[model samples]
Target: MSEEPGPVPAAAEPTGDGLVQVAYLHPHQVSHSWHESVMRLVMYDQLHDARIVGTAGPLMISCGSGSLVESRNLAVSRWLDETPYEWLWFVDTDMGFDPDTVDRLVHAADPATRPVVGALCFAARETHHDGMGGRRITAVPTLYRPAHDPQGNVGFTTLFDYPENTLLQVAGTGAACLLIHRSAAEKIRAEHGDVWFDRVRYGDGRWVSEDLSFCWRLGALGLPVFVHTGVKTTHHKQVWLSEADYPRPGGGEAAHGR
Candidate 1:
């Protein structure tokens, strides 16, 4: 079976509608829920007055049994070299999102400033003891900020404190539902090679994910990463979860992400 096939571009001509062109890239396997989401997204695009450009094209699927990093890098490379799209949207196969996700993410992107914008994704942490000493699995945000390890090695820590329904600047975020401007990828390629996604080991022996590694590289190039908290997404683990599943810092239901 052949892997890493480039996506076939759509034949539509530019409508001069001013919508930013985007390449929808999926580097992982898909689920039935994700397919329904994509169909709804297509309908949303067709019905919306201002549609996302270049979405008429088929999804750029970079399938491989290698590393996730390899698949992601291949997809981004194809988006850069094969297509004229201005943005690359990385959507994981297990994610559940609203129909308007593309519209919100594209509009949130500022190619010169906020070149990378991620939707809110939550992941389950290992079972930890609650205040009452009962062990429980907690949901945590994938967003992060710069921090130092015990040995003073630079790394990232989960950003627990953030405002809801706002664009919060982040050091790194999971690639499940991420938007990357073409210019940002170009800048990174200019400095480093075309390897946009990589897993790096910190001096403290902590391993960083490919997505976070990409974010760090972007940060090095003066590109900022932001997460629009209003754009929520469900991550499928044993069960599908969202930001609403997150346990507040002090354990309250009054506010989200507090």
Candidate 2:
């Protein structure tokens, strides 16, 4: 089989060894209006305090989703092609990450022994109050919305002792606060062309979803993942899920399993 393309010549300023590059995926200009504002908050409050060492370069950001999931993924992939770092993260611009989150991932554990984690996503619970019937307080998670367990299951912030670092049947992850190791990022890029997710525009004339596609592909590869609750961030929106969004499986649908 052909190997994946080599990484672009990595920059040396940000220190690429444990260099964690975050891609603040924000595809506004269609749905929400506070997108760019959230991006600025992240840079000023969180990523700005971040630092890495011993490998390539500094952090990166991309805010070109353009209200379409496909276009947004394109922006992220473009960053991956040009970003020079050992690790990559994808967070929604609205999510506020821990200032020292990069430092945490860099020294999580010795690289030789641990399953090079595909991602380490932060955790947060969003309270969605529907303006109509009573109050529909939804639990909007920051990352790794592992619904495959006892139904309505969110994730953890601290890294658990999981085999291969993955939750079983995890549907997808929230783009709020996702951190990916470079090794796994390379593997993902090899399969899916790059950090930019494949585009799929539905009848609404907008690219619908790609983060789930990206996570599904990674999970299939048996890459480890973690729920880093320490790094709390917000999704910054009050959008609730419709049955159309998260439909049940066939055969009347069983609850998510462990």
Candidate 3:
């Protein structure tokens, strides 16, 4: 990867009529909780649009089908090739979020600078410390910061001590609730030729996820990735996980599980 920042394209201004279009992109399948959360978000978006665009309606939704990577790539292609929306918001079917999640992320983003913004989400399953460090279920955040492994290979590690209720720049984050600008997408497409989301095999023989891959590309292009900690989200696995469940070392609270 180039240490020098790739040239950032100018961000697109809102339409002459003061309209800012946003497309809601999702993968196949939907849970009841997620559906309800999205409905609330859409309702909020409708009101926002009415004030901004002089009309009110649901956001343009595009759902992709297939495997995770495939679905994401398909959604990206559709958003770039088929839609006229200025923003693409990726929301997972298992995610629970506030109605203002979209507004928070959009307000935090500056496409010319911070083009990719994501809301904080916890890992669905709790993890235990390696070795005989004791068996305590620790809740982990999806945010990541760049670091080198013991083997001297560059990679991203989970950000455990991030500040809450603030917008913080990060190396990457989960795609559960991410917002992308059209300019960022165009720059990425010009550089990588449509290979937006794909798993990468690192020098250490470890595979990084598609979301991290996309984030790395954005960083290479001089676009910063930000996480709005105030916009907390839930990741549903066998159980629901939220910010309250995040690990707080020495905070006296019990671990997530026994």
Best by lDDT: 1
lDDT by residue (86-127, candidate 2, tens digit) is 565554545444445444444442232222322334334444
Q: Give the TM-score of candidate 3.
A: 0.75
Q: Of the pair 2 and 3, which is ahead by lDDT?
A: 3
A best-first ranking of the candidates according to their TM-score comes to 1, 3, 2
lDDT scores in order: 0.74, 0.45, 0.71
**lDDT tens string, model 1, 11-96?**
23322333444444454567777788878887888888345533446446656565678778887887778766666778888788
lDDT measured at residue 36 in model 2 versus the true structure, 0 to 100: 52
TM-score versus the correct structure, for each prediction: 0.77, 0.51, 0.75
Rate residue 10 of model 2 by lDDT: 19
- Residue pairs in collision within model 2: 11-56, 14-57, 16-55, 16-56, 17-55, 65-72, 77-196, 157-228, 157-229, 165-225
Looking at model 3, the pairs that clash are: none
Task: Indicate which candidate wins on TM-score.
Answer: 1
